[model samples]
Target: MSWEQIIFYLFAALAVIFAFLTVTRRNAVHAALCLIFCFFFIAGTFVVLNAELLAAVQVLVYAGGVVGLMLYVIMLVRGEDASQVKQALGQKIIAAFISVLLVIQIGSIVYLSFAGKATGRLAQEMARYGNTESIGTLLYTKYIFPFEVASVLLLAAMVGAIVLAKNKLER
Candidate 1:
């Protein structure tokens, strides 16, 4: 196999393993760390797919900013004991079933979408304009309003989080 294929497989394996750990880990801090690794591996996959802008943004925005914020929150909310939390058998079974179904649905959709013609078209488009410049131009020109809206949403979320974390009673 080619180096690209090998790298892709490696990143995909790491991403899947870390994502599973993120969901299943008992400790909240450990889960957050696992999620960071998952994000890193996903960034690697984006790099392998020649999406340098996306890879950089993934690492900067998700791995660095978001994870740092999450770690800070986790530290602030540290509990004396986390092991005492218990999950019911029925809840576990239901969660597992939902996870399995969601995975199967996603796999089916991906498989069907990229089975033949769609893959060729995607490749063609990527080859034509899969660079930072094209993405920036599109974002600023065509999708400017949506981009601004997303920034507003993020700002609102941050404000809400800070409000929720404050100890003072609101009058």
Candidate 2:
């Protein structure tokens, strides 16, 4: 196998592992750190796939902005709740069921791709237009509204955070 494929698999595995750890960790700080690592590895996978713009956005928006926000929120809390999360038997069963379904879905997707049934048309598109150009075209032409909405939502969240901090300082 090529080095690139090996690196891609390594990043994918680490991303999944870190994501699972992020959810399972009892310490909030550790969980948030794991989530950041997970996002970084996900962006690595995107880079391997030749979607550089997506990778940068993934790193900047998710790993930097969102994770930083989460860490800031964690810092705002006073106590360290190191206790394990306890789920009821029913909740555990439900979670296990959902996990199994997700695994099955992923397995089927991999199988189909290997069987030549899931060949994406990205190669053809990239051959016609470069990766960043195609992404920019779609983002500006097709998904402009959603993209603007996301920007606005992020701005609102930033404003809300600043206002909350000011209120706390005033109190």
Best by TM-score: 1
lDDT tens digits, residue span 1-171, model 1: 778778989999999999999888888888989999999999998877778899999999999999888888778778314657677889889989998999999999988887754212345567776678789999999999999999999999999988987899689
Full-model lDDT, candidate 1: 0.86
lDDT, candidate 2, 1-171, per-residue tens: 788778899999999999999887878889989999999999998877778789999999998988898788778873238455575679768998999999999999988777755323566668777888988889899999999999999899889978977855653
TM-scores of the candidates are: 0.83, 0.74
Q: Which stretches of model 2 miss by more than 4 angstroms?
A: 82-90, 109-114, 117-129, 155-171
Worst 10 residues of 1 by lDDT: 116-125
Q: Whole-model Cα lDDT per candidate?
A: 0.86, 0.84
Candidate 1 vs. truth: CA RMSD? 2.7
C-alpha displacement of 104 in model 1, angstroms? 2.6
Backbone clashes under 3 angstroms, per model: 0, 0
Q: How many backbone clashes does candidate 1 have?
A: 0
